[model samples]
Target: MMKKNRLERNSNSYQKQSNVKEVWRRLRKNKGAMVGLVMLVIMAAVLIAAPLFVSYSSAVGQDFSLVLAKPSKEHIFGNDGYGRDIFARIIYGGRTSIGIALLATAASCIVGTILGAMAGYFGRTVDNVIMRSLDIFMSVPDILFTMAVVYALGASFFNLIVALTLAYFTNYVRLVRSEVLTLSEQDYVEASTAGGATSMRIILSHIIPNSIGVIIVNTTMNVAKIILYESTLSFLGLGMPSPQPEWGQMLSESREFMRNAPHLMIFPALAIVITACSINLVGDGLRDSLDPHLKS
Candidate 1:
C-alpha cells in the first residue's frame, strides 16, 4: 500500500512537471508570438469550418453578372475571373494547400529524424555515406530540386508531397544528425551506455528526447516553408488544376486581370502572405523559447 501510494505521488509529480514545461507557458511570455499563434489557429479553424458555413458547390462557379464585383455584404472579398466568391474559395482552398503542407512536413521530419538518428548514433562509414548523400541532395536549390522531381513523377497531390519530402528532408536530416552527434557525446549518454543500455535504447531514450527541442523548432518553421513551396508549385502549373480554388492557382489565373480585377490577385496573395507570416511569427517564438541561447 505504501509503495503504491509513493508511485502514485511520483506519477502526479511527473504530470505536473510536464504541464509546467509545455510550449504555451513560454509562448505566452511573447505577446506577439502568442497573438500570431492565435491568429493562425483562427485561420485554420475558419478554413476547416468553411464547408459547414458556405453553400457554393464549386469554388470556381461563375455568375457572369457578378464578375469583378467588389467587396460587399454579398461578396466579402469580391468576385473573381469566373465570378466565384473569392472569400469562399480562399477559405475552402486553404484546406487543400495547408493540408498538403502539413503532411509533407510531417513526412520530411519523420524520415529525416530516423535517418539522422541512425547515422549519428552509429557513426563511421554510416555517417559518411548518409551525410555525403544528404549533401548531394542539398547542393541544389530546393525549389529546383522539387520541380525536377515533380516533373519526373508528374504532378498529383501525392507526388507533390513526395517531391516536398525529397526536397526538404535533407535539411531535417542534417539538423537532427548534428544535434544527435552533439548530444551523444554528452557525459549522460556515455553514462547510459556504461550502465549496459543498448545503442538503440540510448538513442531512443536519451538522444532523441534531448534533441527534440531542436526538432520542434525546425518543424514549426518548416510548416511555413512547406506552404510557400505548395504555393510555388501551384503557381508553376504543377499543382492543383484550375477551378479547384487553390491559392497558388488563383494567383496564376488572376495575374492577367491585375489591371481590371486586382481584388482577385490581392486577396489570394494576402491569404498566402498573412498565413505564412503568422506561422513564421509563431515559429520564431518557439525557437527563442526552446533554445536557451536564443532566449532574451
Candidate 2:
C-alpha cells in the first residue's frame, strides 16, 4: 500500500510538471511575445552592465568638442546638446526608467491588493467605503492628479514614485476587488470560512492564491503604462530631475535641439517604445497562458 501510494504521488507530480512545460510551450509559440522577450532581455543586459562599460560621470559630462556629434565608432548613439555621450546616457537612463516603473508598479500593487482584498472579502460597508473612495479618485484625470500630487509634494524620486503609485493604484484596486468578489464564492473559500479560519487567514491563504492570475496579468500590463506615464511626467518637467539620465528628461532636454540633433530625441523615444512594447507583449502572453479557455 505504501509503495502504491508513492507511485501515485510521483505520477501526480510528473503530471503537474508536464502541464507547466506545456504552458511554456504554448507561450514560446507566440512569435511576437518571444521576440519582445528577446528584445527585453537584450535591453536589460545593456542597462545592467552600463556602469561597467562607462562611468556615470562620463555619461553626463560635457565636452564642447563632442556636442551634437553624429553616431560614430567613438560614440555609437553620438553626443547630445550637453556633449554627453548619448549611448552611455541611454544605457544609464534605462536603469532609471525601468527601475522607477518597477518600483512604482510594486507599490501600487501592494497598496491596491490589500485594500481591494479587504473590500472584496468583507463586502457590505467595507466594500462600499473602499469602492466609493476609489470611484472619486478614478473620476479625476490621471495626469492632472499626478501633476497636482507631484507639484504639491515637490518633485523628487520618492515623490515621483508616490505620485505615480497613487495614480495607478486605483486600477489594481478595482481589478483585484472584482476578482476577489468572484473568488470568494468558490467552494474552497466557503470551506475555509466554515472551518473557522479567521477572515485574514482565509483571505491570505484561500482567496489571494486563487485570484493571483488576474492580478499578475494586470500588474504586468501596468508596468508599461507606468513607464509611459513616468516619461510623460518627466517630459513636462515634473518627473526625475535633469542630469538624472531618465528617458523622459533626455527627451525634454533634446526638444529645443530637435532641428539640429534629432538623434537625441530618436534614441530615447525608441528606447521607451521598445520597452513598453516588450512589456505589453509579455503581459498578453501571460493573459493567454492564464486563461483556462485558451489552454490546450
Candidate 3:
C-alpha cells in the first residue's frame, strides 16, 4: 500500500511538471510574444543603464538659446523647448513612466482582487452592494473620471498614481469576481467545502489558485493600458508636472513646434505605441497558453 501511494504521488508530480512544460511550449510558439518580451527587456535595460552614464537629472539646467535644436552630433535626439537633451530626458523619463505604471497596476490589482474575492465568495446582498458601487464607477467615462480625480487630488506624481490606481482597479474586481463566481461552484470547490475547509481557506487555496491564470492575463493587459493612460495624463498636464521630463509632458511641450520638428512627437508617440502593443501581444499569447481548451 505504501509503495502504491508513493508511485501514485510521483505520477501526479510528473503530470504537473508536464503541464507546466506544455504551457511554456505554447508560449514559445508565439513569435510576436517573444519579440515583445525581448523588446521590453531591452527598453528596461536602456532606462536603467542610461542614467548611470548621464550625470544630469531629466530636467536640469537648460540652454534656452539652443531651444528646439534639431538632432545633431552633440545631442543625438536634439534639445527640447528648454534646450534639455531630449535623449537624456527620454531615458530618465522611462524610469518614472514605468515605475508609476507598475505601482498603479499593483495597487489596482491588490484592491480589486480582494474586493472581487469577497463579493464573489459571499453573494446576494454583499455582491449587490459592491457591484452597484462598481457600476457607478463604470458609468463614468474612464478618462474623464481619472481627470476629475486627479484635478481634485491635485496634480502631483503621487496623486496621479493614486487617481490612476482608483480608475484602473475596477477591472481587476470585475475580472476576479467573474472567475471566482465560476470556480466557487466547481466540483473541487464543493469537495473542499465538504472536507471541512473553511470559507477563507477554500477561497484562498482553491478558488484563488484556479482563478490565477485569468488574473495574470488580465493584469498583463492592464499594464499596457496603464502606461498609455499615464502618458495621456502627462500629456494633458494632469500627470507628471512640467519640467519633470516625462514622455507625455515632453510631447505636450513639443506639440507647438511639431510642424517644424516632427521628430519631437514622433519618438514619444512611437515609444508609447510600441510598448503598449508589445504588452498586449504578450498578454494575448499568455492567455492562450494558459487555457487548455485553446491549445492546438
Candidate 4:
C-alpha cells in the first residue's frame, strides 16, 4: 500500500513537470513570443539596474543651456523641456509605469481567482451572491470606473494601483469562474472528492492549480491594458504628479513642443508602445503554448 501511494505521487509529479516542459517547448517554437520575451527581459533588467549606472539626479536636474537638446553622445535620448536627461528619465519612468501596472494586474488576478473559485465551485447561493455583488463593479465601463476611483482617491501611485485593480476585477473573475465551472466537472476533481478532500482543498490544491495557465495568460495580457490606462491618466494630468517622470506625463508636457522638439513626444510614446506590445506578444504565445487546441 505504501509503495503504491509513493508511485502515485511520483507519477503525478512527473506529469506536472512534463506539462511544464511541453509548454516551454511550444513557447520556444513561437518566434514572435520569443522576441517579445527577450525584449521584456532586457527592458525590465535595464529599468531595475538603471540606478546603479545613472544617478537619479540626471533624470531631474535641469540644464538651461541643454534644454530640448537633440540625441547625441552626451545624452543618447537628449534633454527634455527641463533639460533633464531623457534616457535617464525613461529608465526610471518605466520603473513606475510598468512596475505599478504589473503589480496591480497581479493583485487583480489573485482577487478574481479567489472569488471566482468560490462562485464557480460552490454554485447556488454562493454563486449568486458573489456574481451579483461583482456585477455592480462589472456593469460600469472599466475605464470610467478606474477614472472615478482615481478621482476619488487622488491620483498617486497607490491610488492608481487600487483603481486599476478594481477596474480589472471583472475580467479575471468571469474568466476564472467560467474555467472553474468546467474544471470542477473533470474526473480528477471527482476523484479527489471521493478520496474525502475538503471543498477548499480540492479547489485550492486541484482546481486553482489547473486554472493557473489560463489565469496567467489573461494576467499577462491585462498588464498592457493597465499600462495604457496609467498613461491615459497621466496624459489627462491625473496620473503621477509632476516631477515624477512617467511616460504619459512626459508626453503631456511635450504637447506645446511637438513641432519644435518632436523627440520629446516620440521617445516616451515609444516606451509605452514597446512595453505594452512586448507583453501582449508574450500573452499570445502563452495562450497558444498552453492550449492544446491552439497548437500548430
Candidate 5:
C-alpha cells in the first residue's frame, strides 16, 4: 500500500510538472509575449544594476553648467533643468515606478482574493455585502476617485500606493468572485464540502487553487494598469514628491522645455509605453497558456 501510494504521488508530481512545461511551451510560441518578456527582463536588469554604475546623488544633483545640455557622449539622455543625468534618472525612476506598480498590484491581489473568496464561498448576506461595497467603488470613475483620495490623503509614496490600490482592487474582487462562484459549483468543491470540510477550508484548498488561472492573468494585466495610474498621478503632482526619480515626475518637470528639449519627454514616455505594452503582451500570453481550450 505504501509503495503504491508513493508511486501515485510521484505520478501526480510528474503530471503537474508536465502541465507546467506545456504552458511554457505555449507561452513561448507567442512572438509578442516572448519579445515582451525579453524587454521586461532587460528593463528589470537595468533598474537593478543602475545604482551600481551611477551614484544616486549624481542622478539627482544640480550642475548649473550642464543644465539643459543636449544628448552627447557624456550624457546619453542629456541633462535636465537641474543638470541631473536624465539617463541615470530614468534608470532610478524605473525602480520607483516599477516597485510601486508591483507592490500595489500585490496588495490589491491579496485583499481582493480574501474578500472574493469569502463572498463567493459564503454567498447570501456575505456575498451581497461584499458585492455592494465593490459596486460602490466601481461606480466611481477610477482616475477621479484616485485623484480624490490622493488629494485628500496628500501626496506621498504610501498614500499614492493606497490610492492606486483602492482604485484598482475592485477589478480583482469582481473577477475573483466570479471565478470562485463558478469554481464552487464544481464536483471537487462539492466533494470537499461533503467530506466535512469547513467553508474556509474548501474555499482555500479547492476553490482558490482551481480559480487561480484567471486570477493570475488578471493580476498580470493589472500591473500595467497600476503603472499607468501611478504615472498619471505623478504627472498631476499627486504622486511621489520632488527629488525622487519617478518617470511621471520627470515628464511633468520637462513639459516647459518640450519644444527645445524633446528628448526630456521622449525617453520617459517611451519607457512607459514599452513597459505597459510588454506587460500587456505577457498578460495575453498567460491568458492563452491558462485557457484549457488552448492547451495542447
Candidate 6:
C-alpha cells in the first residue's frame, strides 16, 4: 500500500511538472485554432490523396488544344495556358510550396537553436561575437537577402531552401537566446554547472529542454511567413523554373489572361491565403496555450 501510494504521488508530481496535458486542453478550447488545424489536416490530406486519383502528367503535360479552356465537367478548375489542369497543378504546387517552407523553417530552427543556446549559455565573448554577427544579418531585408542569395546561387530547390534557412535562422537565434538567458539562471542549471557538467551538455541537455516550448511556438508561427516569401519569389520569377507548377509560377502565368480567365489567379491566390491564414490561427492558438499567463 505504501509503495502504491508513493507511485501515485510521484505520478501526480510528474503531471504537475509537465505541461503537455494542460497545453492541449487550452489549445482544444480555442475554436479558431481547432478550425485551423482541421483546415490544415484537410489541406494536407487533399495534397497527399490528390496524386493517387490524378495522374502526375496532368499537372505538367500540355495540350495546346485545350489552352485557356474554361471550367467544365472534364476540367474542374479548368486548363491553364499550357493546357494543363489548374486543379492538378495547384495540388502539386501546394505540396511544393508548403514542403519548401517546412524544410526551411526546420533547418532554421535547428541552426538557430544551436547558436542561440551557445550565445546564451556561454555569455561574455561568445555572446558578443554570436549576437554581433547575427545583428549584421538582421540588417538586411529578408526578401532582398533571399532574392540575392537565390540570384547568386541560381534558383533551384536546394538553393531556395538554403536561402530561406539563412534568411530565417536569425529570428530563432534572437528568440532562443532570450529564452536561454533566463533558463540558464535556473537552479537546476547552476546545480549542473557546480556539478562540473560540460557546458555543451548543460546547454543541450538542460537549457534547450527547458526553453523548447517557446522555440516550438515561434517556429509554428513562422511557417506562414516563409510560405508567403517563397510564393513572392516564385511570382517574381526567382522561384522554381518554368514548367514546374508552383503557386506563384501559376499566378505569374495566369496574369496575362486575368481578364479572360480570372480563375487562374483566384484559385492559386486562395490557396496561399487560406493555407497561411490557417497556419497563423494555429500559431496564435499555440502561443496562447503555451504562455500559461494568458487566460482562456
How far is 219's C-alpha from truth in model 3 (Å)?
1.0
Off by more than 4 A, model 4: 294-296
Which runs in model 2 stand beyond 4 Å of their true positions? 1-19
Model 1: per-residue Cα lDDT over 186-275, one tens digit each:
998999899899988998888887788789889988989989989999999988767777889889989898998899899999999998
| Sort order, TM-score high to low | 4, 5, 6, 2, 3, 1
What TM-score would you give candidate 1 relative to the actual structure?
0.91
Question: Tens digit of lDDT per residue, candidate 5, span 150-251?
Answer: 999999889888988898888878888898888888998888788899988887877787778888999999999999999998999988998998999999
Per-residue CA lDDT of model 4 for 215-292, tens digit only, reads: 989999999999999999899888998788899999999999999999999999999999999999999999999997
Question: What TM-score goes with each of the models?
Answer: 0.91, 0.93, 0.91, 0.96, 0.96, 0.94
Clashing pairs in 1: none
Give lDDT tens digits, candidate 2, residues 202-273: 988767777787888999999999899989999999988778889999999999999988999999999999
Clashing pairs in 6: none
- Evaluate all candidate structures by whole-model CA lDDT and list the values in order: 0.86, 0.89, 0.85, 0.92, 0.90, 0.92
Who wins the TM-score comparison?
Answer: 4
lDDT of 3 by residue, 50-151 (tens): 857775563466888768889999888888777788888877777788788888888999899988988999999989999999999889888998999999
lDDT of 6 by residue, 228-282 (tens): 9999999999999978889989999999999999999999999999999999999
- Between candidates 1 and 5, the one scoring higher on TM-score is 5
Native RMSD of candidate 2 (Å): 2.8
Comparing 1 and 6 by TM-score, which wins?
Answer: 6
Cα deviation in Å at residue 240, candidate 6?
0.4
Decoy 3 TM-score against native: 0.91
Candidate 3 stretches with Cα past 4 Å from truth are 1-17
